[model samples]
Target: MIRFENIDLAYQGNNVFSDFSLEIAQGEKVVLLGKSGLGKSSLFSLILGFVQPQNGKVFFNENRVDERIVWNVRQKVAFIDQEISIGDYSVSEWLTFVSGIKANHSLSFGGKRLKELMDFFELSRDILNKDISDLSGGEKQRVAIIVSVLLERDVFLLDEVTSALDENLKKKTAEFFVERKDWTVVSISHDPVWLKNPWVKVFDLEKKTWK
Candidate 1:
């Protein structure tokens, strides 16, 4: 569970969240709905312990979320940002390198699991050998989505991850998340089509009140 108790977050000189509060129960799929740069992703940073709130406490279960426990927090969360860079390697090499990261050393990599995921996402097997940099924006986004899933995180922090994908792929990705009961997904998206899922609980970020 993730809980924010009267949290206040600010950056530079602007106040994003002021005395805001909410709790994500054990396995809730919540969506933070707002235009770009409306403090949506910033909330994810707070939940992930990547950024500290100016005031109030962030808690994951019984433990307080802070910089000290961020690595541990990250172990259970996977983030797929809109602008992703898998670096200048072939898709297969990127997958291999990503799986080599300390956090993912225990997981199966670039093998049958990846092939299955790629198939589910409707990506071609040939993409594994293609240059990662040469992939289109939508393709890159899908690759990032696949990588996040490979980590087997219980929570997903998706920041416009499907912004570049076409209608069909977007629906597929949304459906994928809907099927995962263990997933506590907090997503930021401008695409209305993604909101058709029954379990998606939306938070209106543009609202004036912090409560």
Candidate 2:
């Protein structure tokens, strides 16, 4: 659950959000649709404490998010960025590093589950040994998603996550998240596959309307 109340935000003399407000209930699936520069991704930044609103508040699960609890909020939410940038580490090394983080220490990355997810995402297990920098864009995206899944976070912030996937893979990815009844998902995407899901509500950032 996330809520933004009357937010006003700007950067370098340019306004991004003005008196913007939104509330996402638990287990809700929302897709933010709009042209670029509409502050779609900035919403996630506010939720994650990457940026703070000059005028309003951001709340997560009934608790106001601030510096004191930002880490906790991040631990509970999985954010998969459009550009997967985890340096030059190998896939396996990246997985190990993510699982090794203090916030993720309690969540075990089971080899069996990892392989299963990789297979479901149409990725080869052998790719684990490949350098992350060498993987194709689609491969990188799937790998980022798999890592998020392995973390078992109930809330997801997906930013153009299927941007590089093929048509089939895009559908597969959309269906996989749409079927999760207990997960809260807020995504930014232009992919029609996501919008086709009846369970997903589309929020037009530019118009400040929902469809």
User: Per-residue lDDT for 1-211 in model 1, tens only?
Assistant: 8888988888997988889888888778777787767788888888777789999998886579877777788888888876887578998888889888898899987678888999988899889889989999988988888988999888888998888888888888987886789888877876665576777877777883321
Shift of residue 197 alpha carbon in model 1, Å: 1.4
User: What TM-score does prediction 1 earn?
Assistant: 0.92
lDDT of 2 by residue, 1-211 (tens): 8999999999887899999999999999999999999999899999999999999999999899999889899999999997888898999999899999988898878678988898899998789899999999999999999999999999999999999999999999999998999999999998899998899999989899898
Clashing residue pairs in candidate 2 (N, C-alpha, C atoms within 3 angstroms) = none
Q: Rate the local accuracy (lDDT) of all candidates.
A: 0.82, 0.93
The whole-model C-alpha lDDT of candidate 2 against the native structure comes to 0.93
Give residue 82's lDDT in candidate 1 (0 to 100). 62
Among these predicted structures, which one has the highest lDDT? Answer: 2
Cα-based TM-score, every candidate? 0.92, 0.98
TM-score of model 2 (CA atoms): 0.98
